[model samples]
Target: MKRQRNRGRVTLASIAAMCAVAALPGQAHAADDPAPYAFDPEAATVRGTETNAEASELKSGSVYRSAIKPGQKLYYRLNLDDDTNAYVSAVAVPPSGGKVAYGDGITVSIRDVDDTQCGSEDAIFGSGEFARPIAAYAHRVIEKGNSTCREAGEYNVLIERKSNATSSPDEWDLELRYASEPAVKAADAQETEAPENWSSASPVPPSGGQKRSGGSSFYEATGLETGEWHDTIVPGQTRFYRVPVDWGQQIFATAALSNNPKSTEYLGNALSLSLDNPVQGHVDDTTLSYSGEPASVALDPLPPVDYRNRFASASDVSAMRFAGWYYLSVTLSPEVAKSYGDEAIQLRLKVNVRNDPKASPYEGAAGIFGVSDEDKDMAKSGQSAPQAAQSDTMKLVAAAGIGAGAVLVLGLGAWTLLARRRTAPAAVPAAAGGQQPPYGGPTRTW
Candidate 1:
């Protein structure tokens, strides 16, 4: 009988151990899963319609969330007056681990009620061909003497995804933003041409910076000022940061990756750094081949922000036409993991902002183009607008997990105690001094 009880106790303990082990793998798998885009919690969810007649209206200064599938063309409505310039940007986020081709991308355009296209732009996966967030923007500028899309009573935004048959079948999530810029006062409406002469030389990035963590998406991007910042990134991860650039100011940035002592294998295009304008328009990008040694890439010299830069023939100059939060994204190729041991590589950013801020000429709602004191404060704290909500969500999840774990432990303990009692004979009388026996004892330790 003693032998049987001991065996039963061992069996119950083994079963409990197995159950605990089984629960761990699921949690580990979830932790390893790719993180999804962090869309703004306050953003309204809207459905894209197939036709303009049924298109949903997009309000200015608002962010929206939607989705797009392969070969799908969707339309959203916009109501605007003739005086304001309308800028619309669409960001497509492909599922992580999904196969994407070089040609896969998204196109955005703005058209009038009569189907005349006001502006259109497309963004592709390019040589990287990796699953990531790609952004493009279209605008209906209130240009003088441009008769095409100036009168914007009822305009439509057309968004389409381009994908081949071999691409992933998963639907891409979309983030859309609409910004309306009021026309400049007549006295301030002089034609401001792009800079005639500016230094094309690259500025040296600052060294020995404060530590900062980059956001996973534009909405969650960490705010940065002109300075040196440091962070860490693992293979297959892309981190995003934003800098405030006001009119007449220019931004110069450089990204550097630290050497990895674990591996010296050379990988081509192992790192990339890209810059996007306030409206999410691509400005410039550079890549570096890594051989485990330190490597760096700096953006090409860009013109200062000016309203009249829209007339410039070069795309890079034109992209600097507006002033706001310019996004910087740094990506470490997934291939690096094979040789770099999946360890995080140290990253440093040298950022410089030049020129004094200029006064805006807008007669209405021009705050979006300039940086505010609050913006600087946020940057100093390295917090995004939605970070508080994200923190709250994490706290709730942790609390629930703790509550569940307590119940599980308590229930398992009770079951083990009950099983031991049922399998054992009635408790034996205590030894002469009321002490429990050493073998087949009734005293419970758990």
Candidate 2:
């Protein structure tokens, strides 16, 4: 019976492939350009309301998709208990090549029924003045004897987009996430503070590793481990990758832009690399000017992940309080296209995650606060979520070809080859230069 079912699947797949190939000749090929943002396909669509009375309810441990026009204030509702720490993050993605000012960005805040603010955060375009995805999160922490925002029954999440006259008037897409972390057991709760000192030395750059494609947004970020990885980025493009950061682990990463000897034009703020914590909180970022020569940017060494880091006054220290997926965003300035052409540039990442996993003090399940074996496997596979799907699709196509006759199989093979050529990015020649040490700068410690 099992063999019969397998055979039935093969036959159906073969028929589907044949029909697809028959229509391939006249189908228009999609452009190599990716979308400005890749929202999770399974995320629920939500609409935010202007007043709290009509606000949509957001459940914990779920993802939602929404949009906000310029100068609009949207509100969403949340229900919480006194023992769990609730967090709400909003990521705003502006249109590529759109006009933006330095201060243009988004703000998020969490408030109680009495209008007492629990927490608020804002993210901006900064000096780059380029349109890109920016994330900000608001969290409600449950302290033992806190006064404000305590005993939460009903809360409101407020999101607003700040724009100026120079910015684009089009609506910006938003990705919203709500997560709750349970409190530690009473017996396990202990007072802890951020580390006062840590290593300030810059890490050595890694040489080579397997090539992987980066995703366009956090939802589709490629999974990476403690190793060297490589990718290609075109001008005006921003790529995102994620790493599983366990408790007690410290992550150090550096991004290098390969030299382009073919073009020696200088561009300021040509390369940027930014890091965000598990809760989508900004940790640290660095930028470097490019002179058509090899240049790199390295994130300052951060303290190991500790639950008590949240009590620290430093932004960077507090941002590393959670132990989950950490995000890395690398972007190239659009002005590079004017000097170096539209060809993709080589991007090499040197990532080092230190320490071992440690036990948490949560009373129950950690709930997205720690890494699992499956997360490690995904990183080792060196494929993004989308790429993994593509691989499965190709395997199914091959199986279908084998089940079909020789004539149909030959046609399918030709179609596969053509599709690859159409989708692959054009390769640029390697820069002829010796290894250059990371651009020297003041060492920072948090």
Candidate 3:
């Protein structure tokens, strides 16, 4: 029979709920997902500057730096220093060579202009319609440009308030709204790739849907509380959640998470899992786990988790570049469960997460094993058992090495292409006599 497996679908709410389930009883395991918030915490830093047209020159005056990923939706808020009737337009330029990509055509008129309306508003702009005469705002998505900006480079947020008189104080402030990295593709897995191989199992024992033993409860609840969701999650911490299964019963597992509406949050990095017990598998190394511990497995580089359907693409899974609940279905063996129980077995729960503490909706790790409740209980205590010593540091080093190697490979490939182009043979021009020669230069003189 075709081996049944857990499928992955991404959802912010599901991620949160998975952590909550890990906290529930029957499996006294602690959530290890929240450790990042406690360790390296991040906060949103808002900075602003005011410019006057009299002193600000167009070249330098109309530019500022914004940290953003490609395809991220940004809402530009325009505030003109002077309220003279003017037309305002925004453009996003790549800082490398100041290459303009998007936002070039969007222009709004304070008055008289029929194209778009800004009306009698002093300042402020965006998507929401203005109740009273308010300022103007526009949203735009970043588009393809110089490759330099594709990775790390400067970008310009430009605003021009067109008025007969040039010295219109076109003060511009940007709200970097809805910024996110695009979902990395399988081909791009080596660089800035998302974890497509990683997938969440459907909530086992489907909620309110007649609970089946290890059926869908693994992903039923799809939300989580903010502030260190799991107390046990710590840096360099690794543990397993084993869900035992009956001889013929099928099961699945999924990661559960949620973000508070109060603030926007994102899940990133090499969130992964392993079968049985991986001894030396690096996130970048692709070692297909047919059986045995996770050893030197080369993982596909894919985009991090986002609130969406959680399924690693076909290529990603084929490349063995992800870690998710389905991994348990592949690695866990029924024989191993003899020590714990006799039913189903879900094994290998691992994740590396870091969150911005100030953001609402706590972040933590949770694993939902798809197995009969009785079998889950048998393996519960053992499942939560701490990973072998130094697993955290080792995993970190491995991940870093894989990243470094990928970058190196990409850089080398780029350099090789450049070198080949430079060394390629150049076309020879015909001689003045109109006859091509092996050595065209001064051939006649000889």
Candidate 4:
């Protein structure tokens, strides 16, 4: 192992040098499926326990059975949350109480609680599998018999019934036992992986961050009866906004209703408030949309409410309950949309698309939040703060590793020849026939 260790160090040093050189930009190509960065544990753990409420006690009809071999220990755990002497009461019944009277051919033993708070108890029944049904009360005979449930058979184990003379059964839990080789655990089952969910709405280009600009155009607010219809610029499907030459800059527009704030009802609330720009890229590019349209409406920042909007339906007052101004920011890509020859580019946004009332927590929120002053500075400077920090750490680690490798190679090369010289004299052993080899002289050894 010592020799192997030294050889491994030599090989590793060479590989480290190669890796360090590759760390330089353009020296190495990107790799697919990088090594995992951390270790995660996978084990089946009993996450505490639960019990039935007083209204629904573990009924008498509830029954469990076990098939065991001789000398095998069966463990069944019961959780008693509110009962102090619960374990003693449950252990008093015999498994075959409903069967024969004399020596029901079963044994029972109640051991101490396990280390866990759930308090597990070990009950060893008959010696062979067909050990008669030993009720909980037969624990003493089983202790004396020193036999085990050996053969395989169904032994109906029951939760103790409530006695009219004594108090009724309170809350409790039960854990059945199995004596055999551990089967394929649930943790080892195939994992269903889901792609990461909208990872914090990262900025486009993931480095330069983003810049926002706001502009306004003619917004005509129209009213209708409770169940009436209008040509309604239905900001839902697709509505266009005219941007004149003066509004030349990148345009981001939003809509809101100027109405009295209400708390609890879903009526007379804001409806489809969207804007469209022809010269801007599809607002749906980032999945930031409202009701299938390239638009969105403000959402509750705290415990958000459900919202749904259509042409002329009940208002989603949940969207407008908060007594404050709600603004929606629609990001536009001015360069791409200009290709479509339109004098005044029109952009499309959707405030509501469906009539369903299922609301999203992410709704009602305009742009993202949580950016610090430093983040803003980095964005303005066109520098990736996270990437910069990662690069610095990687460079330091790579540099230190390279330095260590160089020292190791130099030291090993110097010590290699010296070690050979020191071990040279002891390289040879007399022949197995108890005689020195005839041609043997000073041999070079390592």
| Model number with the top TM-score | 2
The runs of at least 3 residues in candidate 4 whose Cα sits more than 4 Å from the true structure, single-residue gaps closed, are: 1-5, 10-48, 51-293, 300-400, 415-446
Off by over 4 Å in 2: 1-32, 386-446
Candidates' C-alpha lDDT:
0.80, 0.80, 0.25, 0.25
Model 3: CA > 4 A from native: 1-237, 260-267, 274-377, 380-446
lDDT for each residue of candidate 4 in 1-446, tens digit (9 for 90 to 100): 56557668767866766665544421111121111111111112222212212212221112222232222223344332221112211212222112222222222333323211211222222111111111122110111122332212212222322222222222222222211111122432222222122122211211221221122211111111111111212111112222211100112222322222222222211132322111111111111222212233333111112111011122222112111112222222112122321122223232221121222222223111112344334333323323334456567767877776786777677678767766655667765798755544455334
Q: Tens digit of lDDT per residue, candidate 2, span 1-446?
A: 54456556657877787665453321211223544677776679999999998999999989999999999999999998877789999988888888888789988999999879999888888877777788889999876557778884999999988999878899998999999887786764555556666665655655668787778888778889887898888888888999989888889999989999768887877877889877787888878789888988788889888887888898888888888889999988888889988878889998988877888767776767877786788788865656555566667677767656564455557667765554432222223484332324322222
TM-score of each: 0.77, 0.80, 0.17, 0.20
The deviation in Å at residue 331 for candidate 3 is: 17
Candidate order, TM-score descending:
2, 1, 4, 3
- Cα miss at 425, model 3 (Å)? 99
TM-score (C-alpha) between model 4 and the true structure = 0.20
Candidate 3 lDDT over residue span 1-446, tens digit each: 11111112223334544454444432222342211101001112233222222221212113222322232323223333221111222222112111121122122222211223322111221221111111122212122331221222212223333212222223222222211122333433233323334433322222221111111011111111111112111222222233332211222333222112322222221122322101011112111222222221222333322322112333223212222222121112122222322232222222222222111111222112122343334343222212211234346556655665565566667667866555442344565698665532333332
In candidate 1, which residue ranges exceed 4 Å CA deviation?
A: 1-34, 387-446
**Model 4, C-alpha of 124: deviation from truth (Å):** 45
Tell how far residue 143 is off in model 3, in angstroms. Answer: 54
Q: How much does each candidate deviate from the true structure in C-alpha RMSD?
A: 11.5, 20.4, 27.4, 27.2
Please count the clashing residue pairs in each candidate, in the order shown.
0, 0, 66, 33
Residue-wise C-alpha lDDT for candidate 1, range 1-446, written one tens digit per residue: 65456556655655655454443311211212334667766679999999899999999999999999999999999998877788999989888768888799999999999999998888887777667787889989876667888774899999999998999989999999998776787865667455677766666666669987887788778888878998888777778898988888889999999999988898877888889988788888878789989998788889888877888878778888877889998877788888987777889988998889988767765667767777777777776656534444456555655655665676677778877876554456555787656765465534
Model 3 — which ten-residue stretch has the worst lDDT? 34-43
